[model samples]
Target: MSPFDQHQPAAKPLTVLIVAYLFPPLAGGGIPRVQKLVKYLNRMGVHTIVLTVEPPPGMVEDPTLLNDIPAHTPISRVPLPRWMNAFLGLWRRRSESESGKQDGTHSVDAKLHETAQEHGQARSLNMKQGQTDQRNTVFRKGPQKLKQSVQKIVGHALNWLRARIFVPDDEVVWVRGAVRAGMRVIERYPVDLIFSSSGPLSNHLVARSLKRKTHLPWVADFRDPWTENMHRTSIRWRLALEKRMEKSVFEEADAITTVTESFAQDFKRLYPARDVHVIYNGFDPEDFMELEGSPPNAPLTFAYTGILYGKRHPRYFFQALKRLIDDGMIRPDDVRLEVAGVLDYPGRSENRDALIALGLETVVRDHGFLPHREALALLKTSHVLVVFGDQEATAGRYIPGKLFEYMAIGRPILGLLKPGEASRIIEQFALGVHADPSDVDEIEEALRHIVTLYRSGALLKDIAHCSSKDRLSANERLCANERLSADERFTSEACLALEDRLRRFRRDVQAEAFYALFQSVVGAKQR
Candidate 1:
């Protein structure tokens, strides 16, 4: 039997307390990993009791995800104090309004920036705009300056307070309540192990407290890295403090699990004695069983679902799409791009205007913040699915959770990624086309290849046959002839082998890995 096969326990099932702040009905990138683990671990003779925070207002919510939890599983949801919730609600609304205004202005600024860069007129425009602003503000200066001074002082004080008070993360406030709730759950249930998944990092903090109190064999899971995370705070003192906290938590946990091998390696390097395992984020195959219909029809739709924030913006992808339309290689109406999920990040509004400025508003559809199931259905109906890596050098370390679902959807993938774990996965599986996200020209070429293969009715056939070398060498000049001969395609036997390889990433397989780790950790403690 495969190592991933679930082992049936002869004795009573192990019961684990799963501490995850980002569990459903909170919709996010972090939800699928924890939710799927809960779903499959329960089926594998492990009872899971979830410990999560009550959903805050204005956060994305999907009640549909709750259905994935096994019936009668215990869940303890710790809530914030009423005053704290009210303060957060008001703060969130204000932030939303400010971000909205910033997005609008960002679009306008981007247009100007683009125009200036092309025409070498940036200095001239800046000078002109500055002069106009000075002239306009001269008569209204005294009160404005006073207001600005007061606001700047308050902002500085708030930033200082946030830096100190929100150590590790803002979710630290929930730690006390969650720890109390967890203690109650342990008292009520026959909890055998403690598991926590991090993003807020407070989940681990809560588990750390419980581990101290009860001395349970604790497993801390990092969905993303801690101090080394790409989005981590840049403040020197804060970074130092976070590094210390991260070390302390990892040192206390009996086993540590992360979503990527790269992350696991990093953790091992930092704490060579710690037991670290890679439990990949994966798709529920059952979710895709019903989407196995015929390929989507024309207009050559390319869909991207999930939040577009941070450096994970689609500017390069949009630019590539625009270029294809401008060159008439792709007709405006015959091709479309569908974007789902929150697009409220900085420069994203500007990117939308970039689409319009480049005459592609009609070519790209924006479906903001779709329900998870609806997003999957839309992806199934699209000809191509796109995932953008962060433009930063560290982009390769992250394999977006959505990529696995795209793989299961079995469509031609347009991976605008760097040379990292994610790109290697696509190439290793012969999944689809990938390009350097930073390279507009390369992205355009990759998109061209996808479109060509789709039109020739050879996309799937070509994807299955082409090796990573073949794909990298394929250029615009060679796209049409890139399809290999009939003998070049994998045989039916070989195809089954390839499918077997992909099974390692199935949710059930991943959950089995988790169960094995849990058994070992618990057994080691007993010994």
Candidate 2:
């Protein structure tokens, strides 16, 4: 019999239980991924049940994303108590330190100032290469080592408290609730598999637990890697714990899926024995079909929509633009940069201050945390989309989800990143230009290129054909989606079968061991 023939006719639609900490209502990169998955799964004849937290006060839910979820789809909201979150954060941070991972570090305020001065000097030297006075003047004194040591100690302690104790393992909380709730649902109604995505690292716990209970297969989707993530530094203890957790999940999971090929390779290195697949994030063409024309704005608008982290700094982009403006490469009226998204904690305030200090307060606007759709609308009207690559990691390991969307917009991409995966992708599509994030001159050069093209009105003519070709083909999207879908299907089936056998085997082995111990105890008592 054929493989299809061996399977019984489809009963009810396949049920996908998505366990995510940051879902529709909670704004972040993870939200968009989950929202898209939930939306598309419904179209693919899969019924999705989302298990997520209620948005905390000061956190706004995007109604547009929520509307995309099929009406028939069930959503289970578990309101996380504020106090519990606080404790969890503390515990998680402490756990991170205890595991030997770097939980936090002190803010390098002085170093930033020193770097700024050095950068300024470097710029002067570049402008007059033969001028010894300018070159020597730029190499100023570095930051004090004592202050640096103190900051490192303090930062780590603070990070420990924040990541461990205060932030309850969001994944753990969600997964525990999801497993219990899922079991209740499954007991009443049959379901096939549990699907989850993560950056929080807590979701894996939930998926692992649920798999232990129901014998159902699980698919663990990673939007980013757990240990190899550049934003985080791993302590040996924490690394070991994370490795153990990831290995367990990867081993138990019917399939493991990630967003980028680079991340997939990283996962494979960690879990060499397991199967890992890559699924590049794609756009729904329908959403962009009714494109609203760009609203008239004074300066040539450049927009970046996504979380700004350590490796992906707005300072580089701002400084480069500032240099260009000061040097008259681009006039003030000709350029403006808008950053829209949450600036993650600890560094947000400092970053804001740094921008203001650089005299970019007016030129750079922060529209904090707009809805994804609104951000896309803003993207449509902008002259360029800014794509940042993480400086610490190899450039394609984690391609920002926004890049694909930017390509779909057909706008010129100004990539502020190192030579990596993202740069290669842009080059492959002939979508945009890239520059080293650390080099102000390179950034200025890229900007000058864009400005020249724009001023001459040749940018559109040059990129029009390439931009049209950049559009995601139906087959390409299908192939990308299939990676995750196939992995999910295989993992779900395998996990279910494994759970049944493992649970029984474990019970039998325990029973035999208990009986042997009991007999030995009785013999001793009789003696």
Candidate 3:
């Protein structure tokens, strides 16, 4: 028997098809969780086969994530249709053409001519610094009154086009290809269950089709909620459609899993009969080794490593820093807010405006979308790992995975978020402090607290002390966010302590929880 086989009680390993649209060779926040879960699941005696698409254009290329998966795991790559990418190319073009015909002086004739020019330019665009800003600045330069009117009309038309066409998302193209790949995997492996992970909720949509054909138990995993996301455009019609799709998956999926208990509760509330469980996204401790030793000439850095867009933007963080600079709470030269990801998806650093307005152009650095490993290394050098999410109704539910990454980093954290789980986690574990995302006063207080902590260097000492542990242990409050408090399962400190008592939230442990769920589905005999 394999060494891994001894870890599980199962008499026979249960094979599963993991239909994840986001996986290795493609780098994103979503990829690591799914990849690590597969790694640990396979090691825990669950045979795993991953079905994912070819690297979509513009996805960061990092081949290292593949090294973490169980070496023998089978990964089937479905080539994304060239036409769909072409269609999205058209989407970008449509935005460039209709986005901002602000000035009336640039008549409809001129606008049409300009639109033609943009369509041509958008055909094969390259991602370079200030590219998007230069594009937007072109249309924004026209008349004030006419610009407003033109913008109103153009923006509505564009939004409607997106809503009407990109129903669900751009990855709709991947569904057919994935379903076919999944069927082939099922044929080759004794797959007992179909596991679909989504963001391109298309993964579940693909599994939904396979479930209908093969009569297999389908497990639909929602990493992030579909309709309940605050960062999304809260269009009732769009949500109605997305909810319909979500419900279809819920009805088809034998088991539902979510990254957070809060999200699992949302699913349970939505589908009372479904088996909804919380299988958290976590860190693979191996990815982090001896962090680079502290360097001389290092400024007190506050690093945020992830996508920053919509409500998750660090505008308030910058505002708080600016306030501290004015109050002399911290010297501007002493602070560096290094953001590893872009401000928005199109690589447009929208927060650049906020940074410039706050006169923090010198203090804050936007290191757009570094590779996953590079981002984490950048994080290690910081005095504090900064997490930002707002209190928007839908954004309040789950702990962003970065909190786990921060806990693993063992650094003091500074949270610019609403009074959600992120804030509670910071306080409960002595990880950091939280400030309202938009409130300057509350944020300034938080900043002062963090700066004081940085000066004390207690967190650095704590991180240095936490040598073998994967993350915080018993004495530490599990470092989970306030939103975690809402999950009926996590109501008591005893529950929290018990969960974190033995080990931390490592990918292997999280995968063990998932393997249990898979065993439950297939009714495999315990050894």
Pick the TM-score winner: 1
* Candidate 3 lDDT tens digits, 1-527: 32233346567678899888788777666777788878777666678888988865544555777888877889898987897665445444333333221211111110111121222222212423222333322222233666545644654565565555666765677788888888888888888888888776777888899999998887888887766654444567766877788788888788888887778787788889887787676676666664553422346777887655455677767777788888877776677766665443332335666666776665665455555666776776677778877546556686877887776665677777766656776776666677777787887887787667667764354343312355444223232322233344334564345346324367777777777777777663222
- Clash totals for all models, in order? 1, 37, 5
Model 1 spans > 4 angstroms off: 4-7, 94-161, 292-296, 345-348, 460-492
TM-score of 2: 0.72
The predictions' CA RMSDs to the true structure, in order, are 10.8, 14.8, 9.0
- Give TM per candidate: 0.82, 0.72, 0.79
Residue-pair clash count for candidate 2: 37
Tens-digit lDDT track for model 1 on 30-85?
Answer: 78888999998888778899999887665666678889998878889999777766
lDDT of 2 by residue, 227-276 (tens): 66654534455556666776687888877777777888888887898767
What would the C-alpha RMSD of candidate 3 be, to one decimal place?
9.0
Candidate rank order under lDDT: 1, 3, 2
